[model samples]
Target: MPTLRQQLFRIKPVPRQKEDVETDLKRTIGLFSLTMVGVGSTIGTGIFFILSESVPVAGPAVIWSFVIAGAVAGLAVICYAELAGSVPVSGSSYSYAYATLGELPAMGVAACLLLEYGVAGAAVAVGWSQYVNQLLFNLFGFQIPHALAYAPEEGGIVNLPAILLLAMCCFLLVRGTGESIVVNAIMVCLKIGVLIFFICVGVTGWDSNNFADFAPFGISGVVAGSGLIFFSYVGMDAVATAGDETKNPKKTMPRALIAALIIVTSVYVLVAVAALSAQPWEKFDGQTAGLSAILENIVGSQWPGTVVAAGAVISIFSVTLVSIYGQSRILFTMAGDGMMPKLFREVNPRTLTPVKGTIVVSAVIAVLAGFIPLNFLAEMTSIGTLVAFVVVSLAVIILRVREPNLERGFKVPFYPVLPVVSIIGCFWIISSLQIITIVVFIIWTAFILGLYFIFGRKSSVLGKQLAEAGPTNPESARTDSTGGAK
Candidate 1:
């Protein structure tokens, strides 16, 4: 066994030579498609369902929560922008960690991403189920049975709609990345258009009286709500996941990351303000499809609500697809790095995509969607993203010192200050999470890390590099198609 210091901080950073990066993925996605991926991924289940949860916690001050969450997300995305400029790969934060932190730290990052994307996919699927039921009811005056529409804890046997949505995404992914991302971009535009519609209609009912006692629960409530809404911003990092497949990554990466972050934050803030102005915050409690509920209550008609529900059905479905795509690709990258099973890394020669990996991810996400409550899964995703953000932020600092002369198409403005603030922001957001959530995240992380020590550590591609190359030095190994330095 290696010494504690060696195990903790061993540097197995990948060589930055172009030939060293093994990739079969096509550089197809342009900046617009990439930006849409971030927007589509970020503006999903959180906005659809979390509003109902956050309003009860922070009342009208939930608008501030959106701003807080956006600021933190922006900080993290800036750090990711700088790193993505330097390391163009598919693993997002996991790839960044491997290239700068080392094998052990990379494993930790892989575990967090798996947890993050997996649960996020499931959470988004669950939210889709709600909107599906809402649309069905609005269209036909009847809805799916409670037992088939919710988790067991919610008095349901299984969430069939969520499972079906996962299956649809799996099919889309197996078709190819080019097709899926284009479809995802189209759906993103539709959703944003609908959100704009909601804001326009909702504002018509705005009364200044609703703003009274905006922060009834005080600063603590705003802070707590920020933690919940942070999940809404979790998927912006999905943009960085496209580095390997993006056209002109160094240029496209930073632009898409910033564009998506700004667009999404603006939408969330606008929607929150409109919704708060529509009615007293107390009315938001116990509301499902919160935005639609607000619209319906104001218009005194079901047509507006029906339109919103229909829009949600489309939007959340796209989100589930995009999120599941991100999850599958991350696992594929890990498998290539030898951190996971080879089955996940295998890309279909016909489609030039990881069909098996996509199926595996969809199946797992389907199970979680069918059984777990959205609330639990959303919390797990937020925690996982928070953990990954901190790692990526730290990696920015590490890479700057280790590779001072590295070419960076997009340098993070403000240098160390931005990255440092990003780290602090992540910790602050995490501090507001429920103690139970923090405990569960700790236990889940330990379980993943434990598996690494037992099996992954010895089997990883980096471990083979250490065995064959004699020593683990910066120049000793080269990264292969499988993402391991050998």
Candidate 2:
């Protein structure tokens, strides 16, 4: 019997006719489009809503949280850049892990990514509804019934607007990738426009007294807030995942990744500063539509809030669409690897998209949006993403030592130190989360492992291929049309 380590490290032969797999993704997305996708997906709901939750924990120290989260995210992106350039596959971390770490670890990473991408998408959808309702109330002097706006336990039967937004995104995704990109770019501009407006108007109302209670809960609070706000930085990895689609990925990938990170971090910091200057951190808690609230305070009129609200509603919808797009693509890659059901891998000939998987994901998200509250869902997303980021950071170290002679398009600048810091930073943020988050995370991991051992270990295409051909038979190894292993 093979040892666990052997099974875990067993690399599968690349599929024959690899050209087919390589050509699956249309190479139409460029650096500019990729950057816009990253910005559009990263900036919306987290900045609009999470500040309210995070500020209560860290007071004005939330700014440091933004800094810390951005730094850690930057390190992880550097590592991700190397892996993405090397693999040039569509699975994101899942494919990279499979190539270097083996099948089982890849499946585990897939589960974590499901949470990071799918659940996060749903959580953002819920937040979009909150902003939409706020906009309606501000513009028309009418509010959606509280029952239709919130999830149960918050005294609502279901979040109708959230469900509607999610459904619309699914339809858009099914149409085609080109449409998705155009819509994402438009949404990105709208969001940035509103944020610029907020900054300009908010700065005028700045009161230095709000900074008086900075760090009210001390350094620990800052670390805790960093953990909560880390989700805002999650979309930066989207840039790295476009490795196969980019032109001259070795050069293009790093430029786009670093550029996106800098842009996202700067926007986050500016927003935090403007928010802090506008009001005391204590007042941030429970303030839905945070920028709109700032606008209301600044202009002393409902019009500015209405404008901010409309912008937020449009932007959040786009964020949800991009996030769901990422999730569906990740699942498709896993399915193609034979780690998940083949159904997920099936692409509609007409659309060239993962239709079944997208539908299933949309269904689950709709159910969650209809039932679960946003706060709990957001924490769950943060925990999953932090865990996945740590895994990717560690994988970078393992790949460097194991495949030292392999050609890498991009290398992490500081080597072991940056990755080590990334791991530590991710762990610190994970620790700051609530005990319930830890518990739920443990349960989720356990369930994933259980599924892997039961189904993945036995039926994994890689394992079956290895058993048939033996590890040393280069002749038996599969080759794609491009003469590359899948």
Candidate 3:
């Protein structure tokens, strides 16, 4: 068996030929663009839809839940920035784990991310369907049947709009129509614009009495709500993933991560305050399209509600595209590293995108969107993301002690203290999740680990090279460890 130290540092970084990798993404994505991607990918659905679910748990104190979740996510992103800057790779936490932990561990991380990005896309699509229906109802007094708009658990047959949205995203990705930074920026602005409009109008209808029993369920409720709301902060790590594409990553990456976190947290808090102040927390339960509902309440006319619903539909579509893109890229990186099937590693000769992998992932997400209930999908995403964040927090400490000499452009401030705190925070939040979620997560991890040992371990490039080279071919073994040819 290989020692953990050897596994962690064994990979000698491979220098990719510029021609082999897609140059389209190589152009520097500046801090502003990167920050917008983070905000755009994150600020949808959760605010518009999840408030109904969370308010019942935390009451008006759901605002504190947002604050707690954002703080933990911010800390985790700091650690992610250090790892991303040091590795400068595309696989996000999976790639970081490969360089800092080992092959098997990296495979496990990739499995978890499949849950995080792919299923989250499905969940967001479901939310998009609700807003789309709301828009139609407000505009023309026509609505899709509830059976087509929701899942069976919610007393509906299928989520047709969610499936359609996922399919549309799939077609765009397959055609290599990648989302440009400009488009992402525009979407972010639109989402924020509508949200601000709702907040301003909604505040005018504020009822101070609604906050009287703020912490209705007490501290436990606040913690549970934090776990539920943590899904809103999921995309903040997009900043860390852009390390390879940033101009002057050392300076820009950290600044962008912190800035994005602060902006997203502030927006979430403002929206939460606006919503809670406008009505009693109990009224939020089962309210589809919460923001749109607030708009309707404020204006006493359907026009403003229609506008907010339209904004939500458009922005959530973009969020699905961004998320599915991220998921495909992570899988492509893993395949390139020889952890997955070679088919996933194939990049389109014409578009320079991972066409094969993107299609495969899109198909899976489409099926999930068609069947899975939105609430279950959201909780599952939260569980996977929280686990991955915990792994990242731990990896920072492991790499620091194991490599010590590795070049890192960005470092997490406060060293050991920050990472420890991040780990504790992650654990606290994840613990508040339902027992079923914990059980499902454990089973998923075990299944992935089994697959890794059976297939990934034996066929892994590093393992094969180690078997063939004995002790003399150190460079070959290192190249294999890095997931490329020597």
Every candidate's lDDT: 0.83, 0.76, 0.77
Question: lDDT per residue, candidate 3, 140-223, as tens digits?
Answer: 889999899888888889989998987887777666533545666788888888888888988998999989998999999998
Q: Model 2 Cα displacement at 218 (Å)?
A: 3.8
- Over 4 Å off, model 3: 1-28, 145-158, 177-181, 207-218, 240-252, 467-469, 473-476, 480-482
The model with the greatest lDDT is: 1
Q: 1 or 3: which has the higher lDDT? A: 1
Candidate 2 clashing pairs? 14-486, 16-479, 17-480, 17-481, 18-480, 18-481
- The TM-score obtained by model 1 is 0.93
In model 2, the Cα lDDT at residue 203 comes to 86
TM-score of each model, paired residue for residue: 0.93, 0.91, 0.89
Compared with the true structure, what per-residue lDDT tens digits does model 1 show for residues 122-218? 8878988888877888888898999999999888999999999999889988999999998999999998998999999989998999998889999
Q: Per-residue lDDT for 303-417 in model 2, tens only?
A: 8888878887887887788778777877776665556677777777877777888888887888888788987888788777677778788888888887786666678887899
In TM-score terms, candidate 2 sits at 0.91
Candidate 2 residue 456 Cα shift, in angstroms, is: 2.4
The per-prediction tally of clashing pairs is 1, 6, 0
The 10-residue segment of model 2 with minimum total lDDT is 12-21
The candidates, ranked best first by lDDT, are 1, 3, 2
The local distance difference test score of model 3 is: 0.77
